[model samples]
Target chain A: MTTLMAWRNLRQDPIRFAATVIGIVFAVVLISLQTGMLLGFMKTSAGLVENAGADVWIMARGTSNVDQSGLLNESAYYRALTVDGVESVARVVIQFSGWKRPDGGMESVILVGFDPRTGMAAPWNIVEGSRDALLAPNAVMVDRLYADKLGVSKLGDRVEIVERMAVIAGFTSGVRTFTQSPYVFTSYNNALRYTNVEHGGASYMLVKAKPGVEPAALAERLGAVLTKEEVLTTSDFASRTRQYWILTTGAGSALIMGAALGGLVGVIIVAQTLYSATVERLAEYATLTAIGAGTGYLNRIVLTQSLIAGGIGFTVAAVIASVLAASSASSPAAVLLPPLAIATIGILTLALCAIASLLAIRKLYTIDPTSVFR
Target chain B: MIQTPESLIVEDAVLTYGKGEFATPALRGVSLTAKPGEVLLIRGPSGSGKTTLLQLMGAMKEPDKGKVSICGTPTTGLSQKRLRAMRLNRIGFVFQFFNLLSSLRAWENIAAPLDIIGMDRGAAEKRAKALLAEFGLADRADHFPKQLSGGQRQRLAVARAIAHDPPVILADEPTAALDTENGQAVAQILRDLAVKEGRIVVLVSHDHRLEPMVDREITIEDGRVVEERGPARPKSNALRSTLSALIEARRAASGDGRGGSGARQEGPRISSLS
Candidate 1:
């Protein structure tokens, strides 16, 4: 009955009702878009650790980012392999090197070297060539998304890494880096030729746990033996990397603030819309009172109206946001509207609508049944 | 097939609005009794507290002093919620403005009080349809109140009030905005409701022609009853019809008819002593 009355009241003025619905839709879209962008920002900040197949990473002491590690003694890799739960450990090196393109442009690139035997912490999402292509002489792999930025035209293009020339062996898709520097993937022997790491020293070790073994246990065991380096499980590494860029550097706070502002705007729009709608029908409400409707009944009708408007607005906004999210799949700035994100937006929208109805309900509580006699 | 109303009683009720130096008394110790199957009329000049008294009887307002009761249940000091429930289950109202909910269709408007009583919606709607047909508004069931004529809207208001089968019907100038024909038609319906259904019908009006239809007439002035008529069926149906025509003729001759609009002009109208 409340819904029936609410719907009828809404339908009384089609233009006003439509305007209210549009206002709500505008607010909802703003929130979803801002939140989606924030999620995209956070996901990109931790991309390296999330995409790594290794269960644990042993980085140089005080290494905050996977792409910015200091040199570590290569002997840590052998010590990690002796751990009871350790299956295989891959020797890895990462170093910032200047790349001189044939077009006479220079760009910084992170030269990533991983042992092909352990097959851990390597470039993924390959679109143009096999991972084995990196084994060729002077071979290296880069993401297609960064091809223009890295000054590469095609496979077989020659570029100088740290004054040493290398051939573009493959192109990977969607391997976007958050550090602005592009990743150059190659074999450990090839990487050593391009970086200044000391002989018999690697930047990091990627440790894989054995089947049925937990990565946390493996990390603890390696942590006890390798006192000079820090051992972190995959999830911990990802969290640390995200916190470093997002929280400490304030890279993601701007997006969070934007989402919050969108929410506030949505609340104002919805509250104003519902409030005006309630005002427009104050006489009708007074009539309801005269006809014996209690205050509770009046409140139910208003909340039901708000929910209806919000439900429609959220549906339209979610569909629009999802389509936008899917369309950004190939872009470096991905829009991630995951299931959890969608659910959160749903709860937030409904709660805002409930809050917005408060103003209208306050007006209803002031209605005097005797006013009809006047 | 006899029906009876829960008799209504108001004893020395007093009410005042505002505070301190601004206080103005609205109703002053007005007492009245309306028995089952009686059509009682309250006539008074503007601001005579007739409307305020009617509001008290409907449980819309609590008097600052004195007591109002329906079927011996005193309404003083009752919670607002309880007062509203009593109104929903026992009292019906007809307003001068025909305050029908404009958004709802005629049937929905009529079914509103029934819905408040927690009736099955389907059954409530069926009863509303039947009442609409009885009011000659069957074809207007799906039309919103704004889409109806003034007379039709007033009829809809009356139908809505009585839809829940309340024992008491209180109307304030129900026919003030209608033509003489509509006014007479509405009065006839209220008269039939009281006589045939044995419900208590009380109305406050300034128009004198409605007198023929009521069983008793109480004229009030300055918040007090100046005069009271007998509880007598003084006029026959034919006489009531004739009296309605005479009043319409008198208004037409006096130029108060307002170009055949049939609505009585606002303000005090002098009634013939006959």
Candidate 2:
């Protein structure tokens, strides 16, 4: 019965009801967009660790994150292989190198050099060409999102990395970087040549646990033997990388704050609209109160109205977020609206409206039922 | 059939608004009671606390230094929840402005009190329809409050007040918004509700025109009862019918006899007098 009354009350003033719904929709869209962008960027920050097929990562001692590792002697690779439960250790070279675009424009790129035979720490999603293509001399790969930005188009196209000639051997899909650089995949030997580094010098080593062996146990074993380097399980490495960008560089904090501000604006708008609606109908409410309607009955009416607004607003915002995500698929700034993100936004919208309804409820509590006589 | 109303009692009620230097007394040491099968009318100018006394009797507020009871239950110290329950199940109200929920149609508005009592929707609807028909508003049952004439809206408010068959009916100037003829017709209905149906009707108004129709009249001045008059002869239904017919004739002469637009200007006439 209270629900029916709420429905009727909202219909009484269609324009005002619509204004309230629009306020809710605005909140939903802003929060979803800001949060979606943050998730997309966070994914990029942990791209390499998440995609790497290795069970553990070995980096230089005192390395705070995946992107800030020092070069280790090639001996760390063989030393990791000697640990019990260690299957095959692959040496990887991750370095920042200058790249000359096809038009001679200079851009910084992360040269990820891996063993083409093992494919460890290599691009997991290849949109063009195959892994074997990296076996070719001076062969390298670039993410499709940055292919146009880096001035590379086809697999056979040649570009300059570190002032050394390199061919675009493959195109990786969705391999974006938080550091504002495109990852260029190449063979270990080619990477050494391009970066002009000495042989047997690697920035990191990818370690795979033997079948049926626990990666954590193997990581601990390698940690004991390799005192000069740090060994981390894949999960820990991903977390460390994400936290680095989110906490240290101020990027993560800024994105979270943006999302919070969007939510705050949405709350304020919904609160004001709902409060005004309540004020407009104060007399009617007072009449009800005089006739013996309890607080619970009145609460049901206001909350039902709020939930209706939330349900419609969520649908509108989700549709807009999905469209934005689809269009950004090929752009460096990806918009990610996953199922979890959609669900979170839906719940948040409901909560926001509920909180906004509290303001109206306060006014309800103070109403003198006798005022209806006036 | 209307159940008999339990006697409502107010004992030396004293009520004041504001505090200390800003204090303004609304009611002062007033006392009254209305038994079953009686129509009690309270008359006073604005600020004389006639309305305040009505509120106190209705359990809408508590007196500062007195006691009020309905059906033998003390209401001054009752919890809000309990007071609300007592009101919902026992009392009905008709406000001066005809405070019908604008969002609801006439039938829905009448069904509101029943709905609050958790009555089944179908039964409540049927009862509302019956009540609307009894008030000669059968055709306007589906109309919203704004779509009805001032008189029709007042009638609808009365219908809503009695929808749940509450034993005690509190009407604060139920006819204040209507013309004299419609006002008399409404007053006739209140008399019928009290004498014929055996329910207690307490009306608060400044309109002395209501004097002859009621069993008792209590006049208040400066928050105190100045005079009390009571036990008038109950007017016959034929006289009530004559007053109603006069309204209908005026309604018809003005236009469609529908009262939707024509009844506003048709104030009280000689035909309305018993």
Candidate 3:
């Protein structure tokens, strides 16, 4: 009955109720969308590491993230083979270089080199052509999303990378970097030739463990021969990459702080509106109390009203965020709403409603039932 | 096998407000009792402690000293929870201003007490409807207090007070807000509840016209009872003398030509009467 009374009271004041709910919905949608986009971008920062088909990555000592590792000698591959439980070791090189487009514009790109025969770190998703094309000297693969940006029309077309010409061998999906640049895959030897690095030496080494061997145990054994700052598993590398980007770069902190502020503002505005509505209905509450309604009963009514508003607001906000994410799917903005994000927004909306009704609950408790005599 | 009393008892009831110099006495060493099927009409000028006395009898407030026992239960030592229970189960209160909840409809307002006690909604509603019908408010059962006329609202308040069928009904100026026709109707309802149902009905009001409808009258002055008259008491010099004494006592307590002191001093008299 108390809940029914609360619902009826809220219905009676439609304008106020609607205003508070709309405020909460707006906040939830905005925060959810912004936070989702931020997280999506974070995932992109560690994309290469996450997708690399290797059990372990052997990098230089004191390396914070995979992207900032020191180069190792190509001969290190043979040394890695001598390690017990080691299956295969491949030398890879990654470097940032500018590509000259047909439109006479320059597009910055990250060059990733891998062994063609093993295809261990090859682009897993190809939009056009195949990984075999990379066998050709100076043959390169550009991301599908960046094909037009790189001004390439056909797979056979050529583009200049750091003054060295290369053929557009294929296109791949989701091959993006933290710098918002496209990735171009080529032969490790070819990448070394293009970047002017000494022959027979690569930037890093990716090691795969045998079927019976554990990667962590292999990594530990490899660490004995190498320095403590070198040799990491794929998981370790990815985590390190994420940590470096979040700690050294301001992007993570900025996004989190902005989202926090947005959530606070949203909660305050919605709560204040709800509280005002409750104040306007003071007489109605007093009447209920005078009629022998207990404080718990009255509180249930108010809380139910708040939760109802929160549920409605959260649903509307989630729907709006979903639409935004859908429309922005192809864009670099990548507004993605994970289930956790939606659940968080729902919790936030309920909390905001609860905060807003604090004053109303106190006022309800203080009302003297005998005051109705006046 | 069992004996039941018709009246409520108050032994040496002392109700004081505040403490020390700021303390103001509302009821001072007052004792009174009314028999079953009796209508005790407490009359006095404004601030003669009439309302306070009614509040004490209703168990809304406790006297600072002495015990108030209604239906043979001592209320002085009762915990607040128990006192509230007593009020809910035994006593019904009707305020001067017709304290009906503004949000609820007439029937809902009347059913509130029953609802508080976990009564089924449908049963309580049915009972409230019947009570409203008895009070001539059947057509206004769905109307909110703000939508009803003053008299209709007052009648609804009466219906709500008695909806739980409490043994004692304490009304503080129940007809103060009503016109003569509505006031007579309300008084008649109280009279019927007392005479026909054998319930103790205590009505506190300054309106002397209601005296005729009551079976007995108790008048208070200076926080003490000045007179107790019954239906057998002739309406002659004795009644006039008691009335004049009450007026003089009120004037003396006021000190000033204005009746401000009478208002301040009325609390104790009212408490005593309760």
Candidate 4:
């Protein structure tokens, strides 16, 4: 019966309830997008390293990120193959190069050259082309999402990378770049012409461990002989690259801080809405207090009202955020509202609303018990 | 020592508001009592400590001095938790403004007290429906407070006050906002609760129309009772004063004070509360 009263009270002022729900919807949408974008950027920062099929990476010493790597000596690849747990090793060359469009325009591109036969360090989200296309003469693959930015309209378009002519043979999808510099995928021999690395030069070595062998242990074994190079498991290198962007570079932290501010704004929206609605009915609350309503029961009434508002607001907001996120899945700014991110927003929205309800409960507590008659 | 069988007792209760130099007395050692099956009216002008005395009797507050016992339970010095329980199970308050939850319908407003006492919703709803039927508001049960007429709303307030079967009912000007017909109707219902239902009904109001229904009336002035007591004083003088005051109050209430005593007042009915 009390719950019925609470529900009725929520609907008693439709305009006020709508205003409250609108506030929560705005707050939730802001929080969801901010959190989703933050997670997306963090995941994008290590996209290449995480997708590599290699169990371990042998790169030049002091290599913090896979994209910003110094060339490993040609001998590092041969030395890693000698390691006990090493099953196979593939040479990979990644270099930042300027792509001069046929229209005299220029944009930054990461020229990722890998062994087409081994398929290690190759682009995986090939939406319109095959990996075998990289074997064609001067052939390369570029993300279809970044085609406009890279000034390449379609397949068979020719562009010059670091002054070397390259032909686009394949188009991939969702191969994100933290720097927003589209990746240009090609064969190992093809990359040697476009980069500073010579024919036998290797920037990094992708090492796969034998089945039942731990990559970390294999990395430790490879680290013994590769004195001038660093041997790290793929997971470790991926984490290092991710941390380098989000924490070390300060850009990621700025995004994280923005998300926190969104949460703070969310708290304020929920708190103000609930507080105003509860305060407006203070006389009714006071009457209840005088008629022997206990603190717990009164608290339940206010909290129940908040939960209803939050439930409705969150449902609408989540759907809006989810649709917004889903629509951007194929765009350059693909937002990843993974289950964890959705769950995180759900928990945060409810927790913030619950905390906001305490303001109303506190007002009820400090009120003069018999002020209803006044 | 034989104890009084009164369902409500207030013995020289003293309550002061504020601290130090700002302190002002609200109840000045006022004493009163009433047994079950009686309607007691505390009539006084504004700021005469009438409501304060009612609050004390209702166990909403403890007196600074003296004791108030309701049905053998002494309210003085009891913890707020205990007082809350005492009020929930024993005392019901009907306020001047009708104080019905505006969000709820007529039946829900009546069921509120029952719900607060931890009664199950189904049983509480059943009890509220029965009370609504008994109060001559059977059809208005589904309506909200704003939808009902002034008289029906006050009648509903009275029904809510007795929903939990409380032995004691305290009302602060329950009919102050109603017209004469509504006021008379509300007053008669309160009279029935005391005479027929065997409950103690205490009213704090200066409305003259309530005079004929009450079994006892205490007129307070400046935080003390207007006790007309002396050997030379005739007992009929008390009755005469009561009748004259009633007429004067009716004139003032009706806004025609040409030959009536100017007894109607306003604001902070409890003295020294400002």
lDDT of each: 0.81, 0.81, 0.73, 0.80
Residue B55, candidate 3: Cα error in Å is 3.7
Off by over 4 Å in 4: B1-6, B228-274
Clashes of 2: 2
lDDT of 1 by residue, A1-374 (tens): 77898987787778877877787778777788878877886788777677768999998889897777888886887888788988888878878889898888999888888678876767888888778898877899999888988788788999888888899999998887777788889988788888877666788788888999988988998999998889999999888888887777776787778777877887787788889989888888988888889989999999999888888888988998899899988777778899899989988899998998999999999998888887
For every candidate, what share of the true interface contacts is present? 0.79, 0.81, 0.15, 0.77
* Candidate 2 lDDT tens digits, A1-374: 77787888777778877887777777777788778888887898888888879899999987777776798887887888789998888888888889999899999988888876678887778989988888889999899889888998897898888778999888989888888788889888888898755788788889888899998888899999999899999999999899888788898788788878877887787788778888988998899999888877788888887777778878887898788888888888877999999998899889888987899888888888888777
Tell me how each candidate scores on DockQ against the true complex. 0.58, 0.59, 0.18, 0.52
For residues A1-374, could you state the per-residue lDDT of candidate 4 as single tens digits? 65676688789888878987887888788778877887887888888988879999998889888789998767887888788988899999998999998898999989899877678999888987788888887899999889988888788899898888899889988898888688889999889888889766688899989999999999998998887789889989999998887788887677668767766776677678778888888888878888888888888888888877887888898999999999988788767788778887888788887888888889878866767655
* lDDT tens digits, residue span B201-221, model 3: 899887866888897787887
lDDT of 3 at A174: 64
Candidate numbers, best DockQ first, in rank order: 2, 1, 4, 3
**Better model by DockQ, 2 or 4?**
2
For each candidate, C-alpha RMSD in Å? 8.4, 7.5, 9.8, 9.2
Which residue pairs clash within candidate 4? Answer: none
TM-score of each: 0.91, 0.91, 0.82, 0.90
Which scores higher on lDDT, 3 or 4?
A: 4
lDDT of 4 at A331: 86
In every candidate, how many clashes are there? Answer: 0, 2, 8, 0
